[model samples]
Target chain A: MSKKNEIIVIGDYTVTQLEKLSEEFQTIFVNKTDDLRSLSAASRKNIKGVAFKGHRPLEFDAASFDLLPELRIISNFGVGYDGIDIQEAIRRGIKITNTPDVLNDDVADVAIGMLIALSRNFLNGVNWIKSGEWGKSGEMALNRTVSGKKAGIVGLGRIGCAIAHRLSGFKMNIHYYSRSEKSSAKDWKFHNDPVSLAEEVDFLFIALVGGQETSQFVSKEV
Target chain B: MSKKNEIIVIGDYTVTQLEKLSEEFQTIFVNKTDDLRSLSAASRKNIKGVAFKGHRPLEFDAASFDLLPELRIISNFGVGYDGIDIQEAIRRGIKITNTPDVLNDDVADVAIGMLIALSRNFLNGVNWIKSGEWGKSGEMALNRTVSGKKAGIVGLGRIGCAIAHRLSGFKMNIHYYSRSEKSSAKDWKFHNDPVSLAEEVDFLFIALVGGQETSQFVSKEV
Candidate 1:
């Protein structure tokens, strides 16, 4: 197949993801922008769509986009597309897409796991058992309780809402601060600002998106 | 205050727990059976109730019960009263109580947290970010999804049921095995045997009570 007919896959993707992508499209695999530049002119020209994976900044500027004149869309593997120059893509009439809500459950699960692990002192308990202290010193001290505690979620977006939903099972009183009030989460207390949200809760979960708008979102004041 | 009028607190209790107990009653604190014997005759006779606080076997045999003739009840601090000789306590006309259902939420929270942590490779992710490998290695490899996977709960009692309830929020298919099927969890699949339950799920959580009856509950076969 001609190089121009292929898709470009950039970043550190898993073997399975890469295999799946390869099965579907004749792909030009590159780890970074430099690798993309290193590819032959024909291979770069043939790239019509870019499957951008990883968390690193892609810097999809005009010059980079111009390298692939046939590029129609830049499909980001993760929800955050801060690395991609959306303004540049828009100016050049290219469509930009991101995998957003697809990771909400996974992200929420991790957040809840971290909260529980921390509050319950799981590591301490494990170490106590492993070090034979459980046998010698007897039962470890009682750790803090997690359920019924107040939890504040910053940025009640897809992942935040999912986390709130799971935490509700723990009987936590949910409080949140977002750009605007989420009507769907009417039961949860809404704080107009991050400071108010933090002040009202025992546990605070930050789930804001990355990029200029959300950088330093959870500052000292918050 | 007479030692005979005090409550006997046996086990490795926290300073806070001991302080709390002391505030309520003149507590005769002892961690082992030998310590109980070390108590003055007057102190032993004054004990009316025993607040047993650790996993160490209390060995409330006939001889020990005879030592505290005024002993009326043995209130165990934890959910499992395995360390207490129930039959001996019954024969001696002494009451035994365990703090049941109080820790269901915490136990369930830990179980769910562990499941999510393992499936999502949370430790690996933390290490990646902590070691500065995230910047060097870019994105980590994709991890297994927690939601939509099958989970098996062994001994569907209080903690097991709580775990199942939380796993349901993750959209996990719940499977369980107990002495008898739990009618309340009709929606969850019941395995007549633990082996069958283990065969059907990706994650298996053992929430059985600690005792001789449940000693080898999760055997090699299961």
Candidate 2:
């Protein structure tokens, strides 16, 4: 039979996703990034593209990349492609793509939710009620308020901007740290450095892209 | 000495609050609403007002109101005065006051937080991470999204308006049920009835006043 490898899907994908991908392309399935090594030379040669899913690191070292000579592009399912070797892909004339802005709203919602949860001690309140402590002990202790508080965004990118937009409705004073101030920053205060941004705000949200350069951008010092 | 009674400070009062009230006016301290009957008739005659605190009901029946003949006003410490008998207070020429709009923002923040926590299954995710299920079972099953969803406010009062303002940032289609269309409700759809509003929205927020009329406003049918 002919090699069934126009595309290789790497990492964990739902059955529906796998079926849809197979219906759309000639595909080979691999459970992990390192599984590419097990593919036969003929099958590897037929693989022109990779569809990446899941959060696990996709370490495409030179040796790993060399295994698939016909590889042309890697389409990452999520916004972050930090695990992928960008310089190696560029050097090998391989294209890298990611689904950017697709998750901005969901991510921003989570960020706001987490912020409110922490500020209001939602888990503790739930636990208090569940454990019958609330009935035994009058009321849960009052926690801090999120609205009208100061908030800082570590990276004023698409996701950070989305979070800042939501915080504005809560009447928060927005501050951000970015390499350069964005026009969208508007009335929000911009701090050129993360340290200053962290010092000035009650809450700091880290939204920088995941990569070696940004791995510890909000470090211990910050 | 003159009768030291311009106000009867009832229910739980912090030391600081008791001291503040003492400094402001001649005050009589009563631990409970029923304790009003125990006050000396001479002392009760001098009481002109009441500083009501705590969640316990301040039942002002004819007999209770009759205990303090000079009682003119009940200044409640919270937004809700459901426990105080309004009709009896009004009939006795006694005024009832509450701290309305003081907690609108905080209340709205909590409402949104609870909404996000339920929609995103935040408590379950926390348990998954804590129980180490995330490591063994991969990802948590995806939950519902709050953004771009329809939200209905049962009462478009101050707190409800604040919630709608925040939900607008999430791009939710705002719908409200109120006795009449509020002038402040600009683009939001107004439903004269709560049942119709409940039918059309993904999330329903009840901000109605707590009393007999609204006790079961969002009941089993909703």
Candidate 3:
């Protein structure tokens, strides 16, 4: 019953920082070893927590966890937990954590950049720029204004909320479909159905969390 | 002399929906010309208003205005009006306008996108995606959480405000620098001098109007 917390960071980068936090730490640093079976065979004892990268495909043999009964936490490195089995982890009483906010602005920014580039036909402009279609050149891109464009937000979670807030001043008529009304969300109009949100939105922002609920979304081409 | 108004958009694409407001019978429509030089030449006649692409460079000859005595309103098609000469237009008693509110979401979106792409190394991920690095073997970029990072906003205009609003929920400490304290700004602490703002900011956002005032800002490599 030693209280020194044991953490098997599936990657070493996060643990390097976590180790600096220094609250009596034991970390099993795992970095880019493709075969998890070998690591699982090597590390099936005294594990208290596990942090994993979702990029690589991994599955823990039931026998591995059967031996490591002390494991308590599972921190998914990125925002998604697709790499792990949620129901099994839940049954095992393991708490899962993720990195969410670290990328909100970046993703939001890219979405808008694409919106501007697409609606304004920056692709065409890029062609124009390279071709030296300047002062005496013919017609440029006949682009729609990004300001008054109709926008639909796919999910209204933290990232969705961030996108909506970033879009607040742009004068876009924003439509969103969320699990429930944000009662506090004042600027955007909410819809219960996805099809209805799609009808009016010229620009659609997809921010759905990856899991059983949202895996198939955008499959139909929103 | 008539108080009646007619606007001709001098660009490839015009806001055709703006014509739906014709039911009000206030603003009249002249034909849109995709050619900028021809459009400027046409502005000399009865066309009183013209909108140009603000983000792209436009040719503004004094000779054109020397011909356009009736031109009173010059509206830009996008948010950035760096191309237009405000002083010369003002001297000729021409009022300048831009599609400001429309691009806030778009600009904030790009800014956030750049921040994310830079911070999380999403561009590097893009390199991975482009080079088949994701499917093949490569060193994947792992990022820290965007939450709780120090955020500094350079200006508090509409787009800047939108950026701040979107970032508010991420739980980051917000700091802003403006020429003066914004009357309607909320929650965030303000710093008058950018030196103070830059000293502590981990991520800085540029939202100010481009000019000598904002030029060479964040010039320090630090």
Candidate 4:
């Protein structure tokens, strides 16, 4: 009952994303990667494109690729494409695309937020106020100051650069670790390794891309 | 028996602060403004410098000023001195001083953190992971993007300017409201009032100095 050239959508997407995909293609939706095997043979054969929408490692090796013989593309929704086995896709002439730089600001914002929340004891302060302890206790204990402190960023990618930019406003001395030094990030101090970066700063922020290359990157020594 | 020459310490200071003060002066520590009356007349006569702490309005009016005829200085611990009756202090020939520019970075960091937490729905996302609902639910609902949005700042002072500077990293269009436009903040758009600033931006950060002048500055209209 399906079309001959429909697209396959893997992972749990928002209703809007699903609706948009539905309007564009005769789509086969699967909530989990394992559900792909359960799809009818006829449906799998007709799959031409796959839209991936989750952070889970999508093991699209040669075996999974063989199931969708007509598959030409795997478009990932997020910036990281580590989930997909790129070498395997390349061998089979399958083109892979991911949305990069789209979430840099959001990711950076979260990094800074978490940093401030931790240094400022925001949770404890909020609880103290909500519990009516503020009125009773007179004044809360002073928290650690955030600005003019040293901050280290792991993996100076798009998100890391954005975070460093934000920290500049706080007068923080920026230190970062990346494979290669970025020419545009001349203002910040570059560390050849994560250990040096961590040792030099009061706060360490990890912004590395998720994949085998970065697995255990922040190891025991780091 | 205490020394005739001593400092009057007001408010509930930390033990460390009290210890430091004790080393410097023969101190008369009063937790509350009301407790000033309980001081012995001998101790009252000896008081010269008053280290004022906390936000409670220090009612150093003509009547209270009469109590401490020898009072020379009201040194405020924090930047804002709204609690102290400045006019009465001036009339009584008392010098006043406060620590400023020390807390700008911390306050601005907190403002940005709260904004990100709200826009990103960080609390819900955190709860989902901590409650083990992430394994069951697959993924939480998507949150609104924080960057490339508009931000309004009320009272473009030290903290407000710092917040605007941080938002600029997120590629946000900055709009601010202040009585007079700041020369340094020329890059940002300035609104005559808070109402217009609120209307133009997705998020509004208030960084006004607390006092009678700005008591209801961010009113219903804003």
Candidate 5:
């Protein structure tokens, strides 16, 4: 039922990279402003994959996907597949893949940076210098320490391990809660549950795969 | 000169922890306020091994530390050591330690988060929701894919390595710049200068030691 393998890019992206990516797959850039009918009509003509379905929330449910039997896989652009209906995809025997681990450091870095910014008012201090507050007040004032504190990370995986390695330099007692414990890691302590991990740490980090498993994991405990 | 070995906490802290720490090191608490002179005078008299200097920047200049021979070490409470005169302390042979790796995960998270925030307008989107712009608007927009982007880090040390490791999850091409080169790390591409590193990546991170070699490392090129 296939003439040529078709792939769609559903978000805004650099044309340069898009051109390069097109060599591997047939590409279409469909953003918020896209026409679903055109997308559906295109899918009917032997299109096999939707590479960026989760870029925006789904406009079509499982019923719409059933109309086009050509759709075989939905390659998610990011780790969080909240926008996609997992049950619907699973029912249809459609394969779903997320670009995980790839963005771990970026996301983890952003998360930790945000923590520091919030705890010590780092952004406010930077704003002070930019907005001429430093000239007026002489300084932005002192900030909180980032060391000698309990650091807790949830979903200790690749990104979590990387974070723990970095946290080691800070002399923080690292605590983690995962579905399966890494008994191999003898250096850091582990809590039986998320509540215990949250309670033990002064700084709590959420670094787990997001799906049905880890949605609102931190919301309950931390 | 000697009574009981008194420990000093030279900043605002939770008294519960201090009481616990005092049992180990003769704890003393000195509140840092607007008066800098009194802050230094009070801290100078103490012979505490670990001084948790808070709010006010560490008050002693290098010469002033010379007057207090009993002081052993200054354990900084936070990440940025701007308040302490590190060079002067080095000259006097005083052991100055900082909480470095502790905040690495948190700070790296924030750095990447900020990049995403700035790039995607995550805060603006949140602001839109809080400002009641979400429902009123036809569609809500957030930032783009964090994965598969080029990331360049300055100073490939503990924090820098943490940032790189986290970003590695997103499948980004990670590059670094350090004074000396290493041959063992096959994954990380090393650049010789800051300008070269900045030129390569979509996101730029500054995680270097602040001293003679790195004060203005990520200069205007950013």
Candidate 6:
């Protein structure tokens, strides 16, 4: 195979994604990130790049990187790259790329969508109409409105900012908690802590990136 | 009963609303608009005002209005007053009051909510998780995104304007069909007719008031 075709896909990819990638390159599939360790040293030496996309945590620390000597880069499918050890990747001169801001619009759309869904009881409303209760039992119980309510975002990153922008259209009072106050978030109240953000808002959205740094950030107190 | 206490409630009212009105005034309840014909002339003479609320069309034209000689006002419970004949009410020196702008926020919220729900297939996504299909079937089918899509409003009325304002947050390209272009809709593309508006948009919102004039505004062609 040509050097350009020698790529290893290490992660759980959907069947469609897997099929597309497999057809276009000399791709080696591995179910988990650490499965590269089981590959023979000669076979691993041919791997020039890694395409990783999975829901689980990737074990691509120093030990894992040492397994593929010829690997030049690790391209992550999602925005968050907390799974990979950035420090170790930098020391070994391997480039790390993540798809950032690509899903910001989508994530924000879902955040606002879920807020309205929960407040409006859309699922229950659908069930009410489908089960013939709308005609037999009259209208469904009145649901709370999403407009003019207060919403707080835990981490005002790209996704959080997108959500806040969308909430503004609903005439909602926007509040947020972030490591430092963002200059872009004009007129939106900023809280120094998550608990404070949680206290004064009708809905709290956690937009923090996943990892040890933010795993327990929104504790039981919040 | 005092003159102020004499009120007739026409059309369907919730149990709570009926109880509250009954507690405060000498109120006669009629199940529908035409049921006013059943009231005795003596009983109708005591009715100074009418509280109207129903899902069906109100038959409160000249013939129906003449039944209650003492009727001074018809207070509609909702924003739409298409069912009541405004010209007839004016000729009889009777006032027609509707609760307009009261539901602008709520109607706007549901408009955007239903948009997101349909585009993202939220109900199916919820069922996927609830039916253990998320674990068994992996991920559900990918859904279309709402942000940046073209949306057309059939009428640029109060409720349509509210829906348009909310759609702006989703980064949608707003196109609207109105009788006349609105000064308030800054930069939103205006179409002179519904068919022209429908041709260019992904989602079409029928926000026109329900009545003979606009009953078939969005016809088979659209």
True contacts kept of each: 0.74, 0.74, 0.17, 0.81, 0.21, 0.72
Residues forming the 10-long window of minimal summed lDDT in candidate 3 chain B: B28-37
Best by TM-score: 2
Could you tell me which residue pairs clash in candidate 2? none
**Lowest lDDT 10-mer window, candidate 3 chain A?**
A56-65
Tens digits of per-residue lDDT, candidate 4, B125-161, equal: 8789899998997778778888889989888887888
> What does the lDDT read for residue B59 in candidate 3?
51
lDDT of 5 by residue, B140-189 (tens): 65366565788888888878887777666556788888887757446989
Question: Which digits, one per residue and each the tens of the lDDT, describe model 2 over residues B122-155?
Answer: 9999999999998898789998988899999999
Lowest lDDT 10-mer window, candidate 1 chain B?
Answer: B53-62
Which should have the higher DockQ, number 3 or number 6?
Answer: 6
State the C-alpha lDDT per candidate. 0.83, 0.88, 0.67, 0.84, 0.68, 0.87
Using all chains and alpha carbons, the TM-scores for the candidates as numbered come to: 0.86, 0.91, 0.61, 0.88, 0.54, 0.88
Worst 10 residues of 2 chain B by lDDT: B53-62
2 versus 5: better lDDT goes to:
2
Q: What are the per-model DockQ values?
A: 0.64, 0.81, 0.19, 0.69, 0.17, 0.77
- lDDT (10s digit) by residue, model 3, range B1-222: 555456554444445655543433244343332243454454447766665543444354465465556888777766666666677888888888767676676666555545554566554665677888767775686664565678999888887887787566445678899888986876886999887898888888878887677778766752
Q: Which of 1 and 6 is the better model by TM-score?
A: 6
Give me the displacement of residue B18 in model 3, in angstroms: 16
Best by DockQ: 2
Task: Please report how far candidate 1 places residue B95 from its true position, in Å.
Answer: 2.2
Q: Where does model 6 exceed 4 Å of error?
A: A1-5, A14-29, A37-40, B1-5, B14-43
TM-score of 6: 0.88
In candidate 5, clashing pairs total 39
Error of 5 at B12 (Å): 16
Residue B147, model 5: Cα distance from true site in angstroms: 10
**Which candidate should be chosen as best, given lDDT against the real structure?**
2
Over the true interface residues, superposed, what is the Cα RMSD of model 1? 1.3
Restricted to chain B, the TM-score per model reads: 0.91, 0.88, 0.70, 0.90, 0.74, 0.86
Model 6's i-RMS, to one decimal, reads: 0.7
> What is the overall TM-score of model 2 with all chains considered together?
0.91
Off by over 4 Å in 1: A1-5, A8-18, A27-48, A54-58, A125-130, B1-5, B26-47, B54-58, B125-132
| Model 4 CAPRI rating | medium
Residue A15 displacement (Å), model 6: 6.3
